[model samples]
Target: MATFQIEGGHQLKGEITPQGAKNEALQILCAVLLTDEEVHISNVPDIRDVNKLIEILGNLGVKIQKLGKGNYSFKSDELNLEYLESQQFKDEGSSLRGSIMIVGPLLGRFGKGYIPRPGGDKIGRRRLDTHFGGFIKLGADFRYNKEERFYGVEAPKGLKGADMLLEEASVTGTANIIMAAVLAKGKTTIYNAACEPYIQQLCKMMVAMGANINGIGSNLLHIEGVDKLSGCDHSVLPDMIEIGSWIGLAAMTKSELTIKNVSWNDLGIIPETFRKLGITVEKRKDDIYIPAHTNGYEVASFIDGSIMNISDAPWPGFTPDLLSIMLVVATQARGSVLIHQKMFESRLFFVDKLIDMGAKIILCDPHRATVIGHDFQSQLKATTMTSPDIRAGISLLIAALSAKGTSTIHNIEQIDRGYENIDTRLRAIGAKITRFD
Candidate 1:
């Protein structure tokens, strides 16, 4: 158990580089299992979830070499198939949600895959039907053992591609089916596929490794089955969610901060969403420069004179992941806005913690919250709290950074699972935070 003690009301300055995308790293690292050659990866974020997946790979006899900082080469030339069924593998695999993604590559290359029920933040009902359903549609036998809480997929004869439509634009589901269909015997057409930058990067990496995939950035994809795949080098894009968080943090704390190498073009609707909250975001040579808020930012009104509402949707829409940080930022804005988190039912529960710190928020329902900004007129009082999830944990930290006194946040492991060296990075930018176990 670890905790963070932070003193608020200090303005942070200097340039902070966002780490490589955590979500992208999850998919990219798991894709390493699809090939037997040495797949070199760079700009990998050193986080708990990623490192745990790497450990699971090493446990399965995947030859891994740590080349340097944020660099690694993975060779899955030999594998321990029995390790997937071990109690140890089950325990480790169940500890992280990313572990479930490994099943696709394993099933595609080795004709069998097994996984325990995945574990992650308790935000909402993230079903695995999308994943298993795709595998089943692609000529694999799927079974679930309720007593053991495990899922198994096998293609004794070999996987054969088929035309199927995903029920929803599930990101992991799309990636899983893509990985499986790459080695199948026929053509595969996937409709309503998730076209997020993370998925796009994975497809590009697959192309580099000799997978035949068409429609790289759209909902429809056509894949031709290949005999085998080779390894290639892949460098992940910068973390866009973190960039948005830093933008909100700077505006709330009235700080001057520059987020370096943000991959501006790939941040679909993120910067504009913050600008809707009245933050000045300047794109300077692939970096985002957020100026100090001396005059204070205001929440914009709709054309119909109604209070602005910020909601989450699929790709090309506001990502549900950053709604927590946006809600935190709205607490200090000059006007009121409604924060509607449409994707996850339980994610907005963290608003109660912000309300404890003197922010005016109305929890309309599990999916929506209304925030009335204090506009720096009232300072948030320090309080003790526990983090429920990754985004909420960072949101609370941002709130504490702009509060009146010292605040303590427990269960910081949730934050570390996503963000790499968060406290160390904040300290470099003049934030007063200390970690203790």
Candidate 2:
């Protein structure tokens, strides 16, 4: 396992650019399977989860070539369909949660898709019912092997589109269904779909590839099935989650940092949410300039003097991925705020580590936490900790950077799964972080 040794209380200064969106990369990469022609992709993040999915595609006989840094070309003309049933595939596919997306494109193009139970962060119960349910509604036959924990979907007659009202606006679920519907036989209407930037990017890419799709930035989507799709070049937007993390890091460490080319328009509620916590998020052209919080930040209260409550919802709302970073940043703020993590039940459990670091936090339940800011009056005492998930791992790293002394964090592989070259990036901005394998 890899670990990070961090020396705290250092002010970071410099410009850092956020990598390509990880969530979008996962979905967009899978869409390449829908066409037999070459698709060129730029700004792909070199992270663990994305790399694993790329490797899975290669193992399935997709001709992949590296063009340059953060650029690749994929052609799925002659895929090895038999490889999908091999034991090696089961082992490889089960290691990545994003691998579930490949099933939709495979089932749409090849009429059959099988996947072992996918694995990812142990945050909470991440059900696969939405993905399979959308497939079943589109006329695919679903089968599961309980003993082996495997899932398969097949449509020998090819998929036929149908209207679907999703139980929840699940992002990955919506992406999976959209991929399948692009090649279906009729028009497919999806209501209550996830319209996050990642989903919109996927929709836009599919449209560029000759799939008729409308409603790019709304909860309702309409896709018209086509005979086939042609590949096109696409570029992923900068990761909003990483931008939010950097904003929080700048506030907590009292650092003046400039996050370059952040795709400011795509960041729906992220900047305003941080501003509500009294952190200055200035928009300079396409960049975000976060000045050092020399006097510390203050949590904003409601108009009626009620405590500020921040929660996650569907698109255009606060993202659940950044709630961990928000919670960590609040530890040094001037007032109190309530963080409600509605999507995942167990994500807030990592607050115990912060409590040990001398932060005043109340874990109200599995889904909520109340933080009383220290106002920088008393610095967090450094302590050793273990990363729980990707978000929580980065949250801990931020906390360590703002703490009083040195801190050691184990299980940094969880951190590397999302952020691209995180330690090296931090080092570039004058952070004191060391890696140990």
Candidate 3:
């Protein structure tokens, strides 16, 4: 296990560039399986989860070549399909939740795909029903091994498209279905689909690869089947989650930081959501400039004078991934706000650690929390903690940076799974964080 020992109450300066989107990288990496041609991808984040997926690809016989930093070429010309049924694959595949996506492209091209029960952050119940449900709608037979905890989907005659109204606008689910639909026999219509930038990027990449996809940024997606898809070069957008994290870090520590080339238009509701907590999110060309919060920020109330309620919904709404960061940022703000983590029940549990640090938070339930900002009247006392998930891990890191003394955060692997070289990057910006393996 790796740990981070952070010296708190330090101001960070200089600019930080957000890495390529982790979520998008997961989807795009899987899309490589849809074609046998070489797909060159640049701006890939060097993170644990993405690297694990790339490793899984190599194990499955995808030809992978490193082009440069955050650049790689993948060709799935001679996949070892038999590996999908191996014990080695089962152990490797189960380690990443993103591995579920491989089933779609595999079933699309090779008539079969199987995956062991995938693993990821134990934030809450993350079901695989949506992914499998879409496959079943696309004329694939689904089977579940109760004893082995494995899933299998096969389409002997190839897939045939059908209209599907997704139960929820699950991002990965939508991506999985689109990959399969692109190779189906006819047009497929998906309503109530996830329209997050990651999904839109996946759609755009598929289009560039000769797949017919419409509705790039809407809930309704139409994909026309193609006999074969040729590979094309694609670059991932900067990770919005990381950008949001930097914004929160700047505010909590009263640091003036510039986040460069953030792909402003794709950020959707992120900047504005941060601004709701009274943080200054300035637009400088394509970058976001967050000035130090010398005067603590105040939470904005509703027009009718009710408390501000920030919640996550489908895209174009506040992202659930940043709610942890928001909650921590609110700890020192001038007023109170309610954080509603609607999608996952257990994500807010990390607030207990903040409470130990003297932040005034009321964990109303598994899904909600009310934070009464100290307005910097009281500084959080440093304490030992453990990271629970990727987002929460970064959130705790930000809190530790702004706390009164040194703090220890164990299980930093959770943070590394999403953020690349986080300690080194934070150090460059003047953050005093040390890593111990």
| Clash count per candidate | 0, 0, 0
Clashing pairs in 1: none
Per-residue lDDT, model 2, residue 70, is 90
Comparing 1 and 2 by lDDT, which wins? Answer: 2
Q: Which sections of candidate 3 miss by over 4 Å?
A: none
C-alpha lDDT of all candidate models, in order: 0.94, 0.95, 0.96
Candidate 1 on 11-70: residue-level lDDT in tens?
Answer: 999999999999999999999999999999999999999999999999999999999999
What pairs collide in candidate 3?
none
Residue 414 in model 3: shift from native, Å? 0.6
What RMSD, rounded to one decimal, does every model reach?
Answer: 0.7, 0.6, 0.6
Question: Candidate 3, which ten residues in sequence have the lowest lDDT sum?
Answer: 122-131
The clash number for model 1 is: 0
Candidate 2 local lDDT, 290-348, one digit each (tens): 99899999999999999999999888999999999999999999999999999999999
Residue-wise lDDT of candidate 3 within 1-437, one digit each (tens)?
99999999999999999999999999999999999999999999999999999999999999999999999999999999999999999999999999999999999988889999999998899988889999999999999998989999999999999999999999999999999999999999999999999999999999999999998899999999999999899999999999999999999999999999999999988988999999999999999999989988989999999999999999999889999999999999999999999999989999999999999999999999999999999999999999999999999999999999999999999999999999999999999999999
